[model samples]
Target: MDNLVIAATERSPAVDFDFAAGVLSLKGESYPEDASTVFGPIFAALEGFLGVAECRALRFDFELIYFNSSSAKALMNMFQLMDKAAARGVTIEVNWFFAREDETMKEFGEDFSEDLEHVTFNLATTQN
Candidate 1:
């Protein structure tokens, strides 16, 4: 399948999901006018890809500078999907990257990974 790429906008993040390579990354800020409208298709695409990915090294990178409450919910859902895929034998790695000075973002990342057991979750900080 073709890779899914969504360019970043002032109120949304960029999404780069490479199904064949098993690398899915979301970067930049995220506070879209409608969270579900922005993330629903992404969720669907990820679900479809993970369903047939088999045993593979899947990496999901979330490098968000800022996000709203609704976006937080969407992020949680994405993490849950990754966790489920990992539970089904996919070697999943999730890297949550926040600004070095953003303690709230770091805490958010921690909260999101709290229930993840099957997937390896890493809290990372971007360099100055």
Candidate 2:
């Protein structure tokens, strides 16, 4: 599957979805005017990648500096999809990175990590 690589902008984050390398990364701030429009293609690409992939290990990295409530909902959906994929026997690892001073982002990661059973959630604090 072709990878999805979108440069970060003021209203959106950078998305680097690599199927061959088994690494998916979403980084930067996200507060788009239309959350569904911004995330629809991303979720579509992720679903397509998972459908044809035989890779046993999937690694996802999320490094969001800021996001609105709508984007948060979209992120939850993304995690849910990954959780389902993991439950289907795919080995998944999710690394959630937040700024050292961002307690809200850390809490968000913790909340998402709760329902995940088959995936390993790693919370990391970064300077940037």
Off by over 4 Å in 1: none
Error of 2 at 127 (Å): 2.2
Worst-scoring 10-residue span by lDDT in model 2: 47-56
lDDT (CA) per prediction: 0.90, 0.91
Give a tens-digit lDDT track for model 2, residues 1-128.
78899999998999999888999999999999999989999999988877766547899999999999999999888888888888887889999999898899999999999978878999999976
Model 1: lDDT equals 0.90
Backbone clash pairs for candidate 2 read none
Model 2 CA deviation exceeding 4 Å by range: none
Model 2 residue 47 lDDT score: 84
